[model samples]
Target: MGLQPIGRRVAAACAVVISGTAMTLLLPGAAAADHTDPPCGPAADACINLSENLSWLMSDGDVTFGPVPVSHGKPGYETPPGVFQMSFKNRDHHSSIYDAPMPYSVFFNGDIAFHEGSVDQQSHGCVRLPHDAARTYFYDLEPGDVVEVVP
Candidate 1:
């Protein structure tokens, strides 16, 4: 079939509806269940090596992950790159970048943490991932473990 044209406004509305539906379908619900920690790392918490950075999360001696994209401080307030231990965690969190709710945040450093972030690079000093990825990171991170944030 020839290209079916949609007017600008109609196309935009359709986009919104489609996106909203997708979000609804993906939303975590009652059926969502917690995954037990794997017998060891290298599975869900397996650290993936990256050319730029290495991300990590530990649920206990038994959990951790790595090499995920994360945003750091804005122009002048850049996050210091180094090894730091996780200090805080919240399954339900409010983002500073956007008022929207972030389901998981594992603090690897004071004020600086890892959580779901806006679609674009937007954060003060937090490892931002897609919502699902952040949830996974949160579920896997444990307090007092090192999460290396690199430059």
Candidate 2:
């Protein structure tokens, strides 16, 4: 009777160890699955895949950061899909036309910019990323850097 409890504990410990090892073995594959090669290739500074709702920063044809979740304009206000260049940057930008706050903005096409916004919600003809991603992208891109938005 005394050994029965010890045996159960030993079995549980072994199960835990096996489960942990399995997770460790699977982690690399899972991370690899999360990343995909940017369609615009490594030369492009940034790529936004609207179909995937994904964005990334590229350098020398390699992804330096991202696969971050982004939100684009809703049905009525569709974000224009095309290749553009980063035209301007503003760390504390506000939209006078819409009277809305647009923080960490990186403007690519006219009034359309990549800025901090709710990832779960659509924007008004803008690419919206989470706060951290918006800031990272804003800093990563320079004026004249290529930004491709693809369907």
Candidate 3:
């Protein structure tokens, strides 16, 4: 009777250890899967959360990179909110209208793009990101991929 109780206690301990080990092994994969599933849904390759002033790179529903800081158009030139497809990319694009250097430009709307610029300053109806973030987004987004700008 005493031996039976001891055996049951041993079994319970073993079960706990096994369960813990299984959880430990499964956690990393679960985390990876979570990251791969895009926070913006499958249709969008990138999502710009305007109110947050942040952007993300997504694939297969996963967020591959970023919540990078961005600056959009100022009061008069407010960046339009809607879904737009990437129209083109230019590594050294210059804005003819503004006659300004717009490096690593990824155009998603008529004259607006995701480009390298001062995050602290507003853009001319464009989305401006820091150099590195703009470059990464420029390369990651392809023409025809969706860019959703949400409030």
Candidate 4:
């Protein structure tokens, strides 16, 4: 299939169990301003909340996955907040700058990407996600897809 804009895609809200409570996450459009809504608007395919360490996948203002755990850049090397389009993806990537492994990498902002790593630890600048989440992001998101990073 060719690239399709989020507004053209159809999807339904999903429910996920967090802690002990089952919560329903409804992805909202650009006009959404509810406190429960994700920081990123409907235009974004993926959204990251740095302070909460959470990420979500969305399609046409409908949640496709998450509110899942993630780890981002720590103190000095902070994950910048902005809306960006995905540039590329690498199933098995090697970081030349850090000389480390970055599996299922989905690059959105320069060298900073969403990659498989320990969610409990901080990264240099990338958004580190659990293995499953990273895999999902890598496969589900295409180049030119929008990604939002919020503080």
Q: Best candidate per lDDT, number? A: 4
lDDT digits (tens) for residues 68-93 of candidate 1? 44455666666666656678898887
Model 4 clashing residue pairs (backbone): none
Residues 40-108, candidate 2: write the lDDT tens digits.
Answer: 755578888898888877777767666778999899988888889889999899999889999999999
Pitting candidate 2 against candidate 4, the one with the higher lDDT is 4
Q: For candidate 1, what is the lDDT?
A: 0.49
Candidate 4 — which residues are off by over 4 angstroms?
Answer: 1-37
lDDT score, candidate 2, position 84: 92
What TM-score fits each model?
0.53, 0.76, 0.73, 0.77
Question: Roughly what TM-score does model 4 have, to 2 decimal places?
Answer: 0.77
Q: How accurate is candidate 2 locally (lDDT)?
A: 0.75
**What is the C-alpha lDDT profile of model 3 across 1-151, one tens digit per residue?**
0112132112111111255447432221123234333236577877877787777776655565566678999999999988889999999999999999999999999989999999899888899988766766766788998888877
lDDT per model, in order?
0.49, 0.75, 0.72, 0.79
lDDT of 4 by residue, 66-105 (tens): 7677899989999999999999999999999999999999
Cα deviation in Å at residue 76, candidate 2? 2.3
Model 3: how far is 143 from its true place, Å? 0.6
Q: List runs of model 1 lying over 4 Å from the truth.
A: 1-67, 95-100
Q: Report the C-alpha displacement of residue 94, candidate 4, in angstroms.
A: 0.5
Error of 4 at 37 (Å): 4.1
- Candidate 2 segments whose C-alpha is farther than 4 A from its true place: 1-33
